[model samples]
Target: MNPEEIGLEKPGRAYFAPDDLNDPALTRLIFRLGLPAVAGLSINAVHHTINMVFVGMIGAHEIAAITVVLPILMMIGAIGEGLGVGVATAIGRALGSNSPQRANVTASTFMVLAVPMGIALTAGILVFRRELLGLFGASEAIMPLAEHYLIIVAFSVTLTMLQILSDFIAISEGNTRFSMWTLLGCFALNIILDPIMIFGFGFGLAGAAMATILSQIAAIAAYALYFRKRIGTLHLSARFAAFRADILKPVLSIGLPTTLTSMLSSISFAVLFTYAGFYRGDAGIAGVGIALRVLTLGMLPVIGLSLGGQAVLSFAWGAGKTPRLLAASNLLLLLTSAFCVAYGLGAVLLRYPIAAIFTDDLEIARIAALTIVVTHIPFIFFGMRQILVVLLQAQGRARLAATISIAQNGYFLLPLLFVLPHFLGFEGLLASLFLAPALTALLSAVILFTTLRQLRGDTDLPIATFTNTVSERAS
Candidate 1:
């Protein structure tokens, strides 16, 4: 059906129905899907960096406070991302299986789950704000600021969750441009409001949170309107109200592992912050926090590329195009690796200048520069791991994706951080970050190769059109 036929008002935009996957120009098709997704994710990374930059003007204490609370926010948001990934992958697969009705059910059920989750997260953060800050090893100086930031952020949890749901739905439906526009609008608002609220209004740390929350609310509103008017039939009627186990199972199954992986990363960050606080004090923690924000900026495009690849891979798999799925994964790995290598080199070369941009203090700059240099040594592997995990998740291999997720951040990274630091000190702490992703990538590559071999016997799956078309034309 045409987009218009499906109640989508946008007449000119391209739609990614299941049949679109059969297009012979596989690389072009994948690029179309992945590019806008990458752009949206990159914008998100920029938003975080901008927030940190503006907030850093206040002082190290302010920066440290934000660092303490930001991960907690990410952990909560991971719930939505994890669930969204599951929903998107399932929806794509259902569409591939020629089951539009099933896709609709999955989308609705995911929203239902998100509502309760948002409420629980909001309430939990409000009640346990102090405890959470304390666990992050916040200094007495930073505790009050952290509490202020957390309160505002906690209240915005529902809007953030809904925005994520909308983004996922749009991407899964092949409306990547819509997601991009939504993020662009929100990010623009955030950039404008950040300085105004933080400096002009003199809200300090709370102002930063307010800026973020307001942007999220705006995004949620935009997405809600777009979904209702432009996208397919999504209603709150009784027909859409009922939940299905079959739809819930795959979404949760894929989403839970990714969610757990994000949770582990958040925990790891907390542990690292605690260790930094004990050994280096507030300035050290703040420096590390600043470095992470920089890292977030550097890693943005890679993540965008990874997410874009994921959407393409998922769509291809859902369309039953196994060969295209495989090709897309390999192409993504190669492209991301090249970008990572270039980024790592540039980061090392511009270390001093980059650090200077974030802070004026020499010591903080030195620590941040060192952290950036060390953490990025395994950058290529990290990129590979990201692409592979997405590939596995899209293909319905959540267990493998989850394992890679844990290995990258949790299982290997955390222990290494504590152990290596005891012997080598700060350098060891830095080395652990590099080694974790490198090792995880190696392991993930092996697992992915093995999984593909096993799937060779599944002859019922459709071969990618690119390979098939080339073969047919030759004959």
Candidate 2:
């Protein structure tokens, strides 16, 4: 079939058909896939920021309590996030290669597995709860609140993984709208419930946790409803749940690097929080944590673009459509890089105002503002590296992706975390955040260049000839 003969959306179509991935206008296709992913993520980040704001009102130490608990939460969420990425890549490639049964089985198998993994994690975490709290820099004063928050939050793990898998599977098969609504609905419910549970019912930290799980429950309900409708390409069912080494291996290989990267971030943040607590006490820890949250919120858009772009890239790769892959890579880089530069400048301009939203304490706000300046601004350049990592994953080049993933935090940030603090005190802790991404971006540039060169040679032609290769694999 030619590009014109491929599946495209009809007026009454509920979602884009799998093969429709190749024929949509590049800009429309990328954004149609990307925008909702970013919107949900950005709003969710807003929820966290606002949660910090609500928590801030209780006391600075409560903020400190949250600061300490976040890394632990991230560590848990990373499992779902990482696994979801793996599932998405696998399914997207499978569909592009015209294997719907593989797509169906992959979703069913992973969803079945996610529940047990989440349950085991919750059990393990609760068993080791206090130790983890202390390990992440929860001081004696913050420990009770952190523990209080975490105990309630832990039970949501199974549901969390379920929701993530459902959302990613939906996204992979060209059904991002429902996934977006799931996230947005969860965000709405959590926000509405946060104040009610925290202040109205006087649950405090426990209230926030209650609100979170309730929102997650609602999200899972929504996903279940959507999946039952069977509007999209894949139908997830227990009938398809049998394990196959073939599916699990590629999924793990593609996914674990991302999990490690997120975990490394959690570890680095834990280490940073410890330093902040040592140098600046409760206020510093809260301030630094707040800044980091802001940094993540800011990166959401571009990160969303990169991930969304990855689906497109992976589809093209599996179809052996050289020009579509190159077009995707080019457009993604252009859009993400532009947004990052613009957002970084906005970070510089609004640092104080942004930080002030999370806390009333002048010292914490000032510290957060300074951190935004030091951390958020330079972190813009990471957009380049972020896109590169996702691009590599899209191409199913796990080794290269894993190497880039490690370079981000493991090689650059983790080493710098200890070395810099030993030399320059608190300032150095912040400096590590700034420098690692910069260095990683430099390294990723070399890799990106080399990867592109290899792609050109592998395609058996130069960049100019890729455009003619679109129908090369439509068998």
What TM-score against the true fold does each predicted structure earn?
0.91, 0.93
**Top-TM-score candidate index:** 2
Q: Can you write out model 1's per-residue Cα lDDT over 348-452, one digit (the tens) per residue?
A: 788889888878988888888888877767675667777877878887877878888889788899889879889987667777877887788789779867866
Model 2, span 249-286: residue lDDT tens: 87999889889988998888888899999989998998
Q: Against the true structure, whose lDDT is highest?
A: 2
The reply for model 2, stretches above 4 Å from the true place, is 1-19, 458-475
Candidate 1 shows a clash count of 1
Q: What is the lDDT of candidate 2?
A: 0.83
